[model samples]
Target: MEHKIKNKVEEPFSFKKRLESFRYAFKGFVWLFRFEHNSRIHLFSLIAVTIAGFFFQISKEEWALLFIVCGFVFAAEAFNSSIEFLADEVSLEKRDKIGKSKDLAATGVLIAAFTALIIGLIIFVPKIISLLN
Candidate 1:
């Protein structure tokens, strides 16, 4: 005798399920902050920038740009981390395709970081020069 199995479809998320998902996301963020080295670095940089923004009395527009760039870099890094994690989990072995995907994600993060660095230099150089002058 042969047995047939039926496939069950998952229902859409309800409000409670959505809340639980948000809670899980928050927990993931906390876990990342606590354990991820790059996340720690980004957190430190974010704090430093916040302090500098306040201390330097950076203009509103400059502050906006600084925060935007900072957010972009950190978000890209987080995305890179997620991609690498998924790739590693999906393939325990060092597959070339997975490796390339991870590398591309890392490259994206690097590009964002480098762009942020340039923006920081542009924003801060004149302020530093003025201080010296």
Candidate 2:
């Protein structure tokens, strides 16, 4: 069986429409932050990582890499959340396919977070060790 999506907003873009798009995006961001526990956790982690970057006095190259990896993790989280929302909309009832889809989306966020953590540890661990010594 095929599922049908109802709304299609594919109108040609004007400056006003573009501005409205940004407003919609900001709205979504606030909604996500308000409702999603994981988004809040990610935001807190981002704050700590930024502070650590300053304290560690990482090189410019290291700072760039840290920023990139962090961005990737955040983007993955956003995507995962979107997928979860769509999946729930598709089927509110308990279905095996819906459960697996949600799980797979969650796995994307988990993998991205783990990858960022490893990169962060690699960059900071040596700096921390040297400071200890």
Candidate 3:
């Protein structure tokens, strides 16, 4: 006996749906900035780095790397916050497993943040050296 699998047709794109998605995303960003202290810190750092980029006149390649790393850090923070929210809902009482999971999620964001910092230093250090010489 041969089994036939049915593929559901993808829904046609709608302008309303697209707008709704953007609205939801903006809401999420606002929520994170409001509630997540770390996210706010990252936002401040992002602004400072952007201003420095302009002052230094970073090259196209440098700008690309900066933007990519910033995006990764922001994404990492959002994922971490989501996991924390889920964990809090899952259990109010302290449990080792839940604590471990939350710690791991936080560590992921820390790693992304440090990676971005290192990349920023790499890109800008030589420029600093050139200025001092």
* Among all candidates shown, the one with the greatest lDDT: 3
- Ranked by TM-score from best down, the candidates are 3, 2, 1
TM-score of 1: 0.82
Give lDDT tens digits, candidate 1, residues 1-133: 1232222233654899789989987877776776678778877877887887787799999998988988898788778878877897898897999989988998988888788889888988888899899
Cα misplacement distance, residue 52 of candidate 2 (Å)? 0.9
Give the higher-lDDT candidate: 1 or 2.
2
All candidates: TM-score:
0.82, 0.86, 0.86
Can you list the residue pairs that collide in candidate 1?
A: none
lDDT of 3 by residue, 1-133 (tens): 1232222244676899889999999999998999999998999999999998998899999999999999999999999989988999999899999999999998999899998999999988888899889
Model 3 segments more than 4 A misplaced: 1-13
Give the distance in Å from residue 123's predicted Cα in candidate 3 to where it truly belongs: 0.7
How many clashing residue pairs appear in each of the predictions shown?
0, 0, 0
Candidate 1 Cα misplacement greater than 4 A, ranges: 1-13
- The full ranking of all candidates by lDDT, starting with the best, is 3, 2, 1
User: Global lDDT of each model?
Assistant: 0.82, 0.85, 0.90
Which 10 consecutive residues of model 3 have the lowest summed lDDT?
1-10
For residue 82, what is the lDDT in candidate 2? 89
